[model samples]
Target: MAGANYTLEFGLEAATDDATIIARTVQEVDAALERVIAAASTFNHNPTAFVVERPRFGPLQFPDHGLKIDVDPRLGVAALAWVGPDFDCPWVTKSDRPVPGASLHKDIDSATPFPDDAAITLDQLRAAVHEFRESGGHRPKCVEWQEADGW
Candidate 1:
């Protein structure tokens, strides 16, 4: 499942409170925190190989105690928002899977299974941010319509 790429450029601090629900709810959260140890990782703010195609992932490449993947759960290739001059419309689109080219995770150079090099653009980044703000995380949730699904 290949799709668009997104870099948060920051990290969300551990949500610590006496709220037992949030604390003990998701086991992977703790694992995510531990793996994200150290500031250089941007507090795991930089999760390499985050496959955008699915909303939830598991046993991420860099596994430890526990793990899970929570993508936006939206279907659609990460596209350029086309908001500014920096934007470039893609040749391969959300409707088409990218022909193998650069490795998505090529930049990380670490222990991870996700290929990091996704064909994405600045406008898409901007759009994701704006949408994330408007909604809670960018894009609408849907089981992407695969060609096999009659797309």
Candidate 2:
């Protein structure tokens, strides 16, 4: 939301409605759902009971916001939903394996405040993911680095 140059890119294969997707990406936000989805396994529910295919979103970038991020929140919701009970999609977070496990561990380490380490809240994770997504649009972090101020 910094500038008009905040370019949002979206990829839709089975999705024919790109406008709706874009709209949701920019305007709509649900704090309840957002807070509840604190991990990476909540998106794989097969309400159809036919087994849901794992979602694979590419590296998303927000150039103006300096936030490039991924979207996977199935695990946290599952935990919140069942606690000690068995979840329907045990293999949901298997989708997050490639970049989430080790990659996330390191990235979260770099982003968080320590001492209170190892305990990352939902908002923190959301912010980290948002930062990762919005860092690739067009605006580099230091726009004034090469400016001329008679220096």
Candidate 3:
């Protein structure tokens, strides 16, 4: 079966000119990516991997899977993109159908196939971090998906 492709892009605006938050947020994102990769490995034969190309400046790679995280501190934005074999795990795809799960399914409808664990996990982590930053008076903004070609 052909693998599915996905991408997630988002930005944040802090109340203050805190350059430190950039590094901190990047660290948090890296940790979250680790967790997602771990979860994906259980189900995917070729589990996605996390590789940081640069400390704070990223072009994080998930080798062989064409996955990468591109972050732009100037724009306060990060874009994650993946293109690889479809996750055939029972939890995610059963008989080529998606199983309903947590809030991750909110954006998906009955007709829409469920996204892989990696995508869900990444989205959740992003949302969580965004919320945390918001609580600290930082504004989460421009959460959107971009085409792989565009990224």
Candidate 4:
């Protein structure tokens, strides 16, 4: 079956811990998935027929499979992406809310290919989040591809 890419972005305060951040991120994802199911219901599609891969916290695992969720607490940003079966649903799109202190890189382009080895460890993720926040959410100037390419 053909697959489609999806991403969900949200903001969180820097003072939040890893557990809280991950919990909140998962909750947002769950709500979005529910919306997708609801929307699909109107079209006679069985939303449950599509297998869902949930996100895991603490460390990145099985980088080659399922749904992946990443967060940058410093930027108060969280992102969720799916790499499996296409949902063929219209509700899966960019977030409508304006995330405060979020860089344009917050969302992953659905067309861009994600590498298998790109997984970052929990420590690395936390460090990057800390660094990004410490830097005041300033994104480096991109001289090559467009700004969205950096995300």
Candidate 5:
């Protein structure tokens, strides 16, 4: 996990707590995920999916250079997505939409909304996070991707 560079942004408690938590290593990211799940379980309204991002290396902005993880701890599932140049998850059949499909974090940039199609398991979410960390923040190829609208 040496030299790992990534940012984990949370949107659960904007009015009462810090909105952003930066995780610079794999362990920190794992910890952040754990914290997020715990927070969701205790809160009533599900939070907008949190994001993992790296500093822009080129012209990437907004939906680019980031992987969004919307975890539903109560359901033990999550949605993973990203958007950028040629950067959308490929379609793999449609499924029920996850809660908070399009997450908006107050005071922070809104995460790219996920479509109604895929909801990955917790284990899968962990793997995807690892892949995102390993890839230095590029959208992970570990899971199938569907291109977002206007992509």
Candidate 6:
């Protein structure tokens, strides 16, 4: 079977409404990510993060499969949430000790606090997103993941 088709969901300060971009190819996903990074880097920080998820098939779906990427361009780091079968696991770049006062996706009113040890650098985010696109929406193994408590 082919991998699940995916979509990118995000918001932009320049736009009155949120944006959703369907991605059927790796290039498309990359382009979307680049667009996201650009938007995130804007002085206003319109969208600090975005989500990549598998679209629901007519009658089949895997709500557990997807990733939430929180980007801090100024810091050159990003946090990844593997919202898959194992639940909202945060990628860990170091020990389990959470980053002090870590909060993600600030543009959204209900941004969730993440227990991420340390957000990966922009370069790593690129690799992880690439792996995710290639894997057809499966959890990317490009980095280490530590399960969050109560997740």
Give per-residue CA lDDT, model 1, range 1-76, as digits (tens).
1132322212333223111111211233343333332222222222322212224437663211111111221222
Off by over 4 Å in 2: 1-20, 23-42, 45-119, 137-151
lDDT, residue 96, candidate 1:
36
Index of the highest-lDDT prediction: 6
Q: lDDT by residue for model 4 over 53-97, one digit each (tens)? A: 333345654222222334333444333333322332211113334
Specify the poorest-scoring 10-residue window by lDDT in model 5. Answer: 102-111
Instruction: Please count the clashing residue pairs in each candidate, in the order shown.
Output: 11, 23, 1, 0, 4, 0
Cα miss at 144, model 5 (Å)?
1.4
TM-score (C-alpha) between model 3 and the true structure: 0.23
Which ten residues in a row are the worst by lDDT in model 6? 42-51
* Residues 1-151, model 3: lDDT tens digits: 1111212222222222111112235456555444443432132112122222212223753232222332223322223333333332112211122223422221121323224321333454365334323333212222323233221
Top-TM-score candidate index: 6
Residue range 65-128, candidate 2, lDDT tens digits: 1222223343231111000012222111112222322212212324321111222334444443
TM-score of each: 0.27, 0.25, 0.23, 0.25, 0.59, 0.62
lDDT of 6: 0.54
Q: TM-score for model 6?
A: 0.62
* Global local distance difference test of model 5: 0.52
Q: Candidate 5 on 1-151: residue-level lDDT in tens?
A: 4235645554454233334566666787677677666664343333333235433445654434545445556667666555434544432212355444433221123334345455766777777766666665556677766655522
- Candidate 3 Cα errors over 4 Å, as ranges: 1-66, 87-151
- The per-residue C-alpha lDDT of model 1 at residue 87 equals 24
TM-score of 5: 0.59
Candidate 5 regions exceeding 4 Å error are 1-17, 41-63, 85-116
lDDT of 3: 0.29
Lowest summed lDDT across 10 adjacent residues in model 2 is found at: 77-86
